[model samples]
Target: MPNTQRLLTARNIWMATVRPNGTPHLVPIWFIWINERIYICTAPESIKARNLRANPNVSVSLEDGNNPLVVECTAKLLDKPFPDEVVRLFKSKFDWNILTDDEYGALFEFTPVKWLLG
Candidate 1:
């Protein structure tokens, strides 16, 4: 297991999704790390969302290029009415209320299966 302290303190993470054609699509995103899992918000129609729907395998890493902490995870989209605790964490960490935003798309919960800290 990765050091929870380090993972939680990181400001940003890079999420990697596989395109339909097998290319890697990566983007920086805001995330909440709780209970050893990572939660991220993205548009339902966005490329990352679409890619994850097609393939659940994903990789996330801290933005520190000098000392990378990478994790391999499986992502699943949560149905309507996301967990209240998750919503609260997002609000507290990002100061963004996902619950009240109609523009926000889907919320994805990622469970880590592997870790690589360098």
Candidate 2:
């Protein structure tokens, strides 16, 4: 793993997956590393979730050391609608007090399986 402070203190690049028709879907997302994996909160029925279900195969890239490191693998739903504790945890990271329950629910949960972080 890259030095959390050295490589990630200001890093924002994250792995984003999507299905672009017949072609493979892949893109980099700007994210925050929560707990042990990079995360994003999205609706379950969103395109991203659909694509992940149809094709678990995935790829990710993260800043490692002094350069960008890439990983190819799959992801599984570790959590959805994030648990209350998880939500509170993430909320602490941002000004979540202003958000309503439904607004907060818009953020979901996941974890990287077979991840490769340099």
Candidate 3:
């Protein structure tokens, strides 16, 4: 597998969340890794955001098909006035300012509880 830190720099990671009725909601989205925690921004009304409100348990996987890295995490919705470091990371990685983006108003912080690497 690629270096964990390097893999995190990839443009998109697939996230899986559970719907209220028990089905899975999965999508590929931009993310940042800071201090071993994963952070993603999405629209407040997005499906993933709604699902996360109902259930915080989530699964995230890097895009590599041959050598995969998956993380099992418990996610939390971050309050406004987001951290400066998180803002900087997103700016440098995506060239988009999270603080200025109204479309992506909600931020989710994912803390890894278990990791699967192969």
Candidate 4:
């Protein structure tokens, strides 16, 4: 098996959440992997954020098709004054500060419940 950390360094990841009507909403998003959790920042009114507020269940996957890595997680909305480590990592990886960003202010932390790595 390949290193999970290496897979996570990809520029973007595909995340899927269930809408209120039980339909799937999927999009590619920038994310940071910390410890064993996935962290994301998006607009509060975005479809993904709204869906997660109603239903915390979510799925995320690396974009590479040859070596697939998928994870099922429960989403948690993080309050302002986000963790220092998370902020630093985001700056290092994406060079954007979520705290000062108005559009992508809504932050989420996803805890993996299952993993499918092939």
Once model 1 is optimally superposed onto the true structure by TM-score, how far is the C-alpha of residue 117 displaced, in angstroms?
A: 1.8
Report the Cα lDDT for candidate 4: 0.90
Put down candidate 2 lDDT per residue, 60-89, tens digits, no spaces.
666444675655546565534455655564
Candidate 4 ranges with C-alpha deviation above 4 Å: none
Q: Which residue pairs clash within candidate 3?
A: none
* Poorly placed runs, candidate 1 (over 4 Å): none
Q: Candidate 1: deviation at residue 89, Å?
A: 0.7
TM-score of 3: 0.94
Backbone collisions counted per model? 0, 1, 0, 0
CA displacement after TM-score superposition, residue 3 of candidate 1 (Å): 1.2
Give per-model TM-scores: 0.94, 0.56, 0.94, 0.94
Tens-digit lDDT string for candidate 3 (1-118) = 2257755568899999999999999999999998878999999999999999899999999898877889899999999899999999999989989999999999999998988763
* lDDT (Cα) of model 1: 0.88
Per-residue lDDT tens digits for candidate 4, residues 4-118, read 7754577788999999999999999999988778899999999999999999999999988888888889999999789999999899998999889999899999998888674
Give the worst 10-residue stretch by lDDT in candidate 2: 97-106
